[model samples]
Target: MVFLLFSAATSFAKTPLQPILPLLEAMPSDLHVTVPYLLSFVMADPLKMAMVSIENNLSPPETLQKLSESLTSLLPLLSQLADIIPRDALLWKLKLLKSGAAYANSRLHAVQAEVLFLASGKDNLLPSGEEADRLFKGLKNCRVRYFKENGHTLLLEDGVNLLSVIKGANMYRRGRQRDFVTDYLPPTLSEFKKTFDEDHKLFHLALSPVMMSTLTNGKIVRGLAGVPDQGPVLFVGYHALMGIELSPLYEEFLREKNTIVRGMAHPMLFGSKYETSRQESSRLDTVSMYGGLPVTPINMYRLFERNQYVLLYPGGAREALHRKVCLMSPYLY
Candidate 1:
């Protein structure tokens, strides 16, 4: 791991690493270290004390049941980790994040590698910002894949097709081997029909999604009627309410215009740095296959140069929170 140093904002007490005895006893051998590592931020000292107090207040049987319930929910979130990251080590890693100035774009530009940056949209620790964009821009050969809805632990998230993503990346380097499968491929009409039918069924069963269109001259036209049926178009829009608009909008475009909007995303969708676990590796692969590329200006420029319909949300995570200012802002580029 690369170490970057910057002046500390506040001197953290030089506390000793916490013991792993409790974690080992509480979890399985395979998950002995991984769970605590991922949950370090989540189960910070304060929160752990709170949980202990809550448990202590309960009867023995009740406490056992509560622990069981909590662990069941927490285990899944802890899935991607490969090993138990030592507390001191994890803390040191976190310090690097706190010292963000250490990983400047100028420094990143010095490295020569095919970097695939996967940024999380809901990363609480290192939230999305201009810094990611700057680093992406500075890189020589880099691709970005962003997960618009996921948190920092994308590798542990559901529905990520990791194999397809790797295949796609290799294709990028090897002149587009068309025979390989990738998550990026638009669903075939039949595939879409099956999935859409199910979604349509659910949509009608719950809150029915209504699609509106415009009238041209005298006749009603599809939403994408004016868009060229050829190459290279960009669609800019707001990310509203956890980007609820994304699915409906994509479905609408495919239904009406037969267009697939390639989205620019944060890099976390690609995977985690500590992809020690097979499960985590699998999840990142799924994200790549789904055509989720990292948010980068260069990637967008190239897509436009190649004539693809790209989807861009100027207001990213900020707008998704339903903040009025974020939603009402004129531009967020």
Candidate 2:
């Protein structure tokens, strides 16, 4: 809702999204029909962009007809979606709109919008994965969740649940300030079952991983009773074989200590590098579902501020993936 509006006023101020446009500077996208279909209505009465979405107001029939013709030439797709929406034919117009339109990234760094990039792996239309990485690096408050299995229309996909993503990311808030501790929502019943009983079932049973904590007095013992049950606990672990140590680490802690060990994981896992097509998805999903976030100072600060159990692997993936390593050379990149 726009503030400072006069009810009787016929005009509302509007500006092109030139500031928000260059978010992912080189974010590559095809001339998708959705762009034109979207722009078709808004572009029709460019001056009345805000009014387009007002009560009972709609775009002219000719605008939709123009979009239909453009969609028709795309063939079977045109046949299937012609009655609905098209993507390819009008994609170029989006490119032109992006390039030809007045744009500037000067305010990019200052923009404080909380950005969450949900990139689709099968999205041939645009490589949002690449954009996720760029935005994560450029934006001050940004997070990325790359679904390698999803398509361009991520939220619409059966497997891609938007609500779950926001919940898992701890993006929910009550007011202007976000209390990571208060706003944090633990995994629900389905999420718990999916992460433990289903996704990591094999490892949870077959490996039956174990954890032992050291008491302040120096003696080590099984169960979390030895460790402090309070918050702001830090557990630094050596990288294990293919991150196999993660399941037990997260599971054992939650089961024994009733605490979730938030892993400050390599950005590659949460960013765009970890590909399920090559590596197994179970391990990957575990990292995300069970308090695992991209390694960033902000993430570290948030976990600690929430007084949650923090897990960090100094070796990261390098230690797990490196070969012909010597014990003396502890650090692997």
Q: Clashes in candidate 1: how many?
A: 25
Worst 10 residues of 1 by lDDT: 1-10
Candidate 2 lDDT, 1-333, residue by residue in tens: 111101101101112334433442333344332343443332232222222222222357755664455444433442344335333333444455444422423454765766555665554444455555555577666656676765555554444445566655445567675554455566665666556775678867888776677788988887777777887878888866867777777767777777788777765554433332222234555456576766767778877887888888877666776554444322345
TM-score of each candidate structure, all chains considered together: 0.39, 0.45
Task: Give me the runs in candidate 2 sitting further than 4 Å from their true place.
Answer: 1-162, 165-184, 217-219, 273-282, 323-332
**lDDT of every model, 2 decimals:** 0.49, 0.54
Q: Pick the candidate with the highest lDDT.
A: 2
- Residue 116 lDDT in candidate 1: 54
> What TM-score number comes out for model 2?
0.45
User: Model 2 Cα displacement at 314 (Å)?
Assistant: 1.3
Identify the candidate with maximal TM-score: 2
After superposition on all CA atoms, what RMSD does each candidate show versus the true structure? 13.9, 14.8
